[model samples]
Target: MPSPAAPAHPAHLSPALTLLLATATGLAVASIYYVQPLLGLLSAQFGVGSASIGLLPTLTQLGYAAAILLLSPLGDRFDRRRIILWKAAALVAALAFAAWAPGFGALCVASVAIGLMATLAQDLVPAAATLAPEAERGKRVGQVMTGLLLGILLSRVAAGSLAAVAGWRAVYGSAAVAVAALMPLLWWRLPRFVPATQAGYGELLASMGRLWLQHAPLRRAAMAQGLLSVAFSAFWSTLALVLAGPDFGQGSAVAGAFGLAGAAGALAAPLAGGMADRRGPQAVIRVAALLVFLSFAVQAVAPASLWLLVAVAVVFDLGVQAALVSHQSVVYSLDPASRSRLNAVLVSGMFVGMASGAALGSSLLAAFGWRAVPVLGAVAALGAVVVSRHGRRA
Candidate 1:
């Protein structure tokens, strides 16, 4: 059963609040990804082996998965505004710590903290759903998610360009400053959220397990999205390494520019959301997964061609992101009051897949070659397609 409904809220979210939510989500989530484009530079600076450098992203994703499971559900039991504020402050500090870390080990520790605090972005998504009217929920969530997807894509571009000019430390330092500035603005403009449930923390968590078992749609959404995330993470976590190899001999700046190709994919979020609102998310999932599989398959065969890789990136990123919006639409509709916990379960699965992909992709890239990375992605995308095909309808 749906937990007691949240106190009735406004039927529509204002434009200004929507933009604030989007901006906040984007900036918060960007912290986890800023290191990706800089992996090669970090490898050289920290004197770590290429394969070991992959551990940074792996640890970050692991930390994120842990936090999503542990902390994200707190939004339902407490005022989401308070949770967002507290996490934002910690995120700022973590980013600063990462900027000044004197060694790779310290940097890795800081990366975990960055991931933990970045759950603020996840908080904002449920908050958006809580605020928007039922009729507009899909569109509103899509808008905020567009900010999130852009932040994930553009952070690479920004980090690469900034690191190229001022060095990697400056990239983290600038992120710290940007997030710090946003906090006061968020505080000033964001409204307080009424706690959706009065359950104690332990009961609240227990309820999540009940929710998972109670809804087949929730389980399917999590499984399909998690599988898609494996492909998404594998491609991104290894792209810099691929570009740095003799096949391309490109630098971080060039690898970061490839984020531009992925940015094109962000356009799919609102489109997918609108489509889901009209036609339902299931069809969208099937088509989007196919796009991802095809994109990765092509890249696996022609890994050496930069132009082909860029084109494939655009297609696969679009597929991955579109599927995410559709999955969220399905999950959010599961239980109105349980949106936070449901989101936690869904996104936790995604980051687990991310952690796995980073670990697996790095190992494959090291053992086999760049071709192997996309092959892994192709296989994972195919699995997602299979899951969508076999699963119960959302």
Candidate 2:
């Protein structure tokens, strides 16, 4: 029998290619988060209650979760380059629709579409893993993850600042233009990926369930990371509301500026990746989760103190980003041939937690007030620590 066909177009990851992957991942994922800082503004403009406006991010994250489960696995069955380009075009359209949305209902529809298309970011990540040599996989994944983390953190800053000056619509318009410009560059640069499997789409998706069951580590990583995401998402989704309330008397710009505090988390990504490579991801996960728990616990005590909140943001953001990088390293190592499907399983869990957190954060904020938000985050993060430790013992 013929030797199994070598995975097609296998090439070492060049510096230029790494940079492209990182930039592409950042831009794509950023699209999902641009509405976060603008939630307060959106609530006011739409004349809706806090819980209702919170549904926007919840819908976007739910869309992302749906796409990760439904679309990301296709990378293993098709040329990732083709998938990226097609998704990029669709993402541009979605962003444009969001910008031109004439009503709150239209914007909600656009948010879901944007989340679905932004799974291109998920594609770029596994592509990075596929390109890198095994020894360098963790570090390279970390570098790409750094871009993803920065995109998430900085998008809030850009959206809030731009929304303050030009209105929220301008933020979406500019993002659409950015994604459009990115397409030609991606077309010119990204190499064609050899499809990893010829399995039909149904089989490909079914494989994800098998992978989840076959790999205990994958499940644990997904669970811990998912819990951490609850803390991270809850904090960000509710932050603007907390700042805008009578206690702080701030606006979107100030809310956006908080992203700068979390910039420290961006810097921590590569370090976390390297640490996972050196010490293993389990220790990293436990320590990182504890850090998140502690940071949020402190924030719960002094929720109204701006300076304390800034410090809490820096520490917790660092912990959350570190845990994510470590989790990716764990999942990517499990099944090389099924990297895309494995990632789909891992990130699907994460976005589910994000959707839950956004909804829960908004409800908690509305019912009990801002003080309750941090407590929810603290509880979720502590649960991550317990899960990580339980995985180790098992």
Q: List the residue pairs that clash in candidate 1.
A: none
Candidate 2 lDDT by residue in tens digits, 1-394: 1113324445677777788889888889999999999999999988988888889899999999999999987888888888888999999999999999988999999999999999989898888887898888867887888778788889999999999999999999999999898787777767678887788999887888899889999999888889988988898998999999988888999888888998966576558878998999888889999999999998888636889888888998889878887887889788877776787888899999999999999999999999888999999999999999997898
Among the numbered candidates, top lDDT falls to: 2
Global Cα RMSD, each model: 4.1, 3.8
Error of 1 at 253 (Å): 0.9
- Lowest lDDT block of 10, candidate 1: 1-10
Q: Model 1 misses residue 346 by how many Å?
A: 0.8
What lDDT does each candidate get? Answer: 0.87, 0.87
Model 2 bad stretches (over 4 Å): 1-14, 132-141
